[model samples]
Target: MDKIIYAILISNDRQDELTRLLSGIRGISDSNLFNITYNDISVVASDFSSNKIIVDKEFAIDYARVIEDLAQHFTLLPVRFGTLMESPDAINEILIKYYDEFKQNLQKVENKYEFSLKVLWDYEKCSGKIRLKTESEDQNAAKLFHNNSVSTEYLLKKIKEHRFESALLEHVEQLIGEISTRLAQLNPIHKFQKMVTPNIILDAVFLLEKHKKDEFIQAIDHLKSQHDDLNFLLTGPWPPYNFVEITLK
Candidate 1:
């Protein structure tokens, strides 16, 4: 059978114990979950019938769940949702090929975990409030209504709308900047996605020291004080999903 690789884990040469533990779990489609170990690292996997296609989201999430279970007992590098190999030998070859890179990555993330932070806001509410703040400037522009021709009025309205949009964008950037400054103090290695949309203003992931979990939370709470307009959604001390650095063919 073909195989789908889920993650790479640190085993410290304990392949026998790792195998014993893996024997109890099931992978996708009720297939057996297994591993491809080399020295102190192993790639967790499952039987994947190459011809029987199942690329749906529910199955993919099930795949993630399998990795999540193993991660509870080991530090691992999670592969992107669908990473398949032809056989155990192939995975073993991959382990050797990427051994140094994997070791370095493991070293970098040792005794640490990942956390995600997202901030959502009420689109209409925030936009309306922002419009009110800049309305004075807009009102002045509106009062400069010179030519009463249809095209002239349309152009003026368009200009006013563009100005309001620029104002909204600037306000959002300021919020992101403030959050970034606060997170920087936490000294975390992170990847941040900001201004994804008007409603989803920030989506960030932090690779933080395990012991600093509380400090990270405290930082968020303190940061929240300055922005009452946005909603903060923070998830994870997740197993380094965004921090993994190696790949398998």
Candidate 2:
């Protein structure tokens, strides 16, 4: 049977503790959750049968939920959705092979958690503002166009488009800058992606000490109150999915 892996946990209590935890929990397909240990590390897994309950997106998320539940009491590296092996020995070998790297990663996230902040803008409203700001310039440029000067028409048209895009991007950058400036004070490491969607102006992920969670939420609340024009969805004291940087061989 193939083995389905859940997470790699750091437990000084080692084999006995892992076995006890596995015994308390269950795996997919109602398979008994088991643990494979290497020194101080343990990966929670179970023997997966061929007629196995295949893991789909919902199931993967459910699996993540289980790991998240466990993370409350354990320091672990959440395996990305689908990490599997053939035997308990292989899982043990993996733990031995990747032990140091896993420990380093776990250490970083030991007492911290992750949060997601997605700021969505009303695209039509923002575009309307851009249009209003450029209306006169667009009108003036349109008047300069003639049938004889195709080059002028092309240049003018390009310039209008350039102006519109530049204005839009500038607005986006300004908003992102404000949020980044505020978040920087928290000293939480962050990843900021801009213009992910026409409506999504900024999607940011932050890794912060668990104790700072309230402060982070308050910061977001203040931003929301200040920018009622846009919507902010703040989710998570999530397992540090975004914070995990280690990759297993």
Candidate 3:
């Protein structure tokens, strides 16, 4: 049977505690969960048949659930779903090879949780306002080009479109700046994606100290109150899925 690895965690002399915890939690296909330890770190895993496993949403969710449960009890680096090895010896070899990398990552996420925030707006309404503003400004520039040739008109239109895009981008950047400034005091390690979609202006994830969870939510609430035109959807006190930066060989 192949071993499907769930997470690599800092065992920290808690071997007996970890054993008791895994005994109650189920892995994929209701398989028993166990730990393979080396020094102070351990890899959580379960028996799996690589050939027979269903590669589907349900299996993925089950895999994530096991990692999530482990995270609640230990500081862990979640293994990618479906990570399999031929035997415990292979897993031990990996543990020996990447021990330092795993230790560093686990330390970084030791007492932190991940949170997601998405800022959305009515694209049509917001873009229309920007378009109107840009068009009004363009009219002044249009007066300079007295030659009303076909190509000239087309160039002017394109220029207006470019200006509108630049302005929209500027607006998004300003918003991101404000958010960063507001959360600077909390000192979260954050990643932000701008313009994920027309409506979803900002898609962001933050690795925050677990004890500061309430303060983070309150800060988001205050931000939402200030931006009545935009919708804020904040989720998680979850495992640091986005913040983990290691790739297992």
Candidate 4:
């Protein structure tokens, strides 16, 4: 049977505790969950047959549930969904080979949780506001194009599109800057993706201390109050999903 791995965890002194935890949780398809320990590290896994298991949404959710449960009790690096090894020996060898990297990543996210924030706006309304501010800049653009004797309807149209994109990007950056300043006191590690779509202006994730979860939420609420035109959707206190950076081929 293949072992479907869920997470790589720091076992250390929690060996017995981890055992009890796994005993109560069910792996995908309700398979019995078990630990394969290698020194201070461990892999959470279950017996699985890749050919028999239907690799679909429900299966993936069940797999994630196991990892999520374990993460609540342990500091772990979540193995990507669908990870499997042919045998216990194969898992142990990989654990031994990547022990240091695993340990380092586990330590980095020891007491932190990942949180995501998506900021959305009414695109048409926001665009109208931006257009008002850009009318002067558009005139300057037209003047420059005219001076070059390169003015054409298509060229001006392209310039307007470019200007709108630039303006929108600048707006998102300013918003990100304000958000960073507001959260700087909390000192969480964060990442941002701006302008994912016209309506979805910013998508951000923060790896925050578990103890500060409430503070983070309140901070976001205050930010929301400050920006009535934008909507904020915040989710998590999740397993450090966005913070892990390891690849074992």
Candidates in order, TM-scores: namely 0.87, 0.90, 0.96, 0.94
The candidate with the higher TM-score, 2 or 3, is: 3
- For model 4 the TM-score comes to 0.94
Model 2 Cα lDDT, one tens digit per residue, 25-123: 767666788766677777888777757476588677668766886787788878877677988888877888888899899898888888999999999
| Candidate 4 accuracy as lDDT | 0.89
Quantify all predictions' global Cα lDDT against the true fold: 0.85, 0.82, 0.90, 0.89
Query: Among all windows of ten consecutive residues in candidate 2, which has the lowest summed lDDT?
Result: 13-22
Stretches of candidate 2 exceeding 4 Å from the true structure: 14-18, 137-148
The TM-score, computed over Cα atoms with residue i paired to residue i, of candidate 2 is 0.90
For candidate 2, give the lDDT of residue 27: 71
Q: For model 3, state the Cα shift of residue 202 in Å.
A: 0.7
- Displacement of residue 27 (Cα, Å) in model 3 is 0.8
Which candidate has the highest lDDT of all?
3
Ranking by lDDT: 3, 4, 1, 2
RMSD of each: 2.5, 2.3, 1.3, 1.7
